[model samples]
Target: MQAIVVEQITKSYGAKGAVKALDGISLSVAKGELFGIIGPDGAGKTSLLRILATLILPDAGEAYLQNLHVVRDYKRLRSLLGYMPGRFSLYQDLSVQENLSFFAAVFGTRIEDNYDLIKDIYVQLEPFKNRRAGALSGGMKQKLALCCALIHKPEVLLLDEPGTGVDPVSRKEFWDMLQRLKSWGITILVSTPNMDEAELCDRVALLHNGRILAMDTPAGIRGSYERPLFAVRSDEMYRLIQDLRQWPGAYSCYAFGEYAHLALQQSLQGFDTQADSVMAELQQYLESRHHTGIEVLRAEPGVEDCFIASTKDR
Candidate 1:
């Protein structure tokens, strides 16, 4: 059985159920798989994770974790799952060690019993064991929260935006820790707005505007971007974007780093938009428009490029 199963889950809020948080989303995660729900804010990632964690019920559809219904068997499912929300929810007044011990006790397990599971992470916290939970740095607080979540050695782990507000180094370390945990045969589901992290997962589902735009391995998603794309650079970066977007042979254009990536419109009345024939004419067009030091070259599409293209309509 899959570690987690979500089938046509839908959720909404507000007086007349106006704001739709999730809309008919369905996906499953296999045991020992690291899956990512990739999207920007308000993409229903948290709602989906919360529903799987049994923190909230969906307005429609069913969800299961370890073959147990999330709503029907929440009591049993809770014990088999470890969930770390986007925000730090630890007790601020408690010491680091106290917070860990409290969560272990709540789950009917002693810290010593699970010491083997969290020793690597706990070592970093040991030096600050006496410090109040609120006194620790953002990264330390995240570590402590993770230790508490794993205190009982859950079968499935759910993390919602664990990297948000974390330093780049800490984020890298946290992802490394997750890779280590995966070796122990634990299923992990992580949600994040960061597109770069999506490539690290075994597979990802692109979420946008309360819906999934695409679901595939990182390479597969990049491969699906069928358009011919070019990275364009000129002295006037801002003006280049405006001109590219208005260009007759441009299918899609958007800013990417220092260049504006332009997707070619393959078929145009008088323009040969193919990569081989378009460069000279395109350069001349820019030159005619008074763009200096213009450089245009074919570029490989990354995950972010595919995402922008996928959700451009919505």
Candidate 2:
């Protein structure tokens, strides 16, 4: 069964149509799945999430949560959905326990009644139960927010960039917690800007410029990458990039990590081209100009590389 369904959803702001936050986005998440929307800022991820949570109305199209219309059945849907927005929206004056209690009260429940639902997470916050919400660390605040979101035992969880401001270790831990939550049969839809996080999802939709570039498992997305790629590094990195871009045999070149990833244009001389040949020519060209420390080798493309390549094509 589909936990959430969005069909041709669109949202815009300003009289001149200055911003098109979401543009005809259509997607669905299966029940009990960990789905991810991977994209950088302004990719329409927040807009889509708000629409699905029934917090904001779409300018066009329709959305449903568990076969119930988001617009027409918003009151009923609210009781079944948990949302953690991009920004931490908890009350600053409230204590950790108070915040959780407040949210539970809003949902017509008490902490003890649904304590089992958030027990694992709430234990970590128990030490800070009496502390003000605003005083917690970024990671701790994230944990507290999550506990509050799940307090009501919502069937569908919508998290927007839950790890954006947290430390690397905390980010990993948060994802691990999410995996555990998935086993409890809750449908999760998370949005994130980190490419590494995308691989954690059962399926991911790559959003760029308010459009869906691709949607598939991480392995499937990586398998779609074509063309041989090589990483090149030299002492004269700046000059190398400029020169390589102008090189007749180079199809594309861009900075990646400590080296530049390059896609070479196929040889027109009907000769079987090899990495050695390409490196030899590049080395000679640089050496004649008094350059040194040149290194070139074939490298596997990663998720970021694929994202860049796909968005560049669009």
Candidate 3:
């Protein structure tokens, strides 16, 4: 069964003329699947998540969780859901154990009652059970928050940017824990700005400016980028992007890390795209512009590259 459903849900703040936070968004998550809503801040991920959690209502359209309407069935919905907001919302003054126990109590359950659901994560926190939540490291705090969210064994889990502000090791560990949780038959819907994190999800809906840019498996989205892409770098990194974009043969040029990932414009009539020919032309153009130490090579496109290309126009 589909665990979560959102259809053409549009939400905006301020006046009617104001920009929307979630523009006609529609998506669904399968049972026991890990789905990600991938976008940067202000992409309306949190707004959509809140709507799905039945914490807030959308301006238009409908949303459902576990076959229950989010607006009409909010009371029972909250009981059947686990939500970890983007920010650390736990009481800072409480100890880890105290916080965990409190959440369990609120759900009408005890920690030991759902011990198996949280064992893997709780053991990691057991050593710091006495530590004040505010005193914990970023990663430890996140783990504790997650444990509390799962303490009730909710059928669906909503994690909003759970990796934000944490150390890299902690981020990796958090995702690892998510993978294990999927096996326990909980539907997981997570949102994040990290491009690499998109690949970890079973499927991702790419959101930009509250709009659904693309929805597909990571590979399916990346595979849609059809063009000869190249990584071009010169002694002047910043100038390289500007110059390449101005190049007659370049279709698109954007900075990716230390190098610029550029797509060269194909000939008007020919179906074949000669990657080497375009590279040779780019090299000559850079050389004429006195660009030294130029390195231009074909690049394997990634999720970020595809995202940029997909959203650049709209």
| C-alpha lDDT values of all predictions | 0.91, 0.87, 0.90
lDDT head-to-head 1 vs 3, winner? 1
Give TM per candidate.
0.94, 0.92, 0.96
Candidate 1: which stretches are off by over 4 Å?
Answer: 267-273
Inter-residue clash pairs, candidate 3: none
- Per residue, candidate 3 scores C-alpha lDDT tens digits across 1-314 of 89998999999888773979998888888999999999988999999999998888899999998999999999999999999999999999999999999999999999999899899999999999999999999999999999999999999999999989999999999999999999899999999999989999999999999999999999998888776788988999888888888988778998888899987566333424555676677799999988999998878788898888878756
58-122 per-residue lDDT for model 1 (tens digits): 99999999999999999999998999999999999999989999999999999999798898899
Best by lDDT: 1
TM-score-based ranking: 3, 1, 2
Judged by lDDT against the true structure, how good is candidate 1? 0.91
- Alpha-carbon RMSD, candidate 3: 1.8
Full candidate order by lDDT, most accurate first: 1, 3, 2
Candidate 1: TM-score? 0.94
Candidate 3 runs further than 4 Å off: 267-273
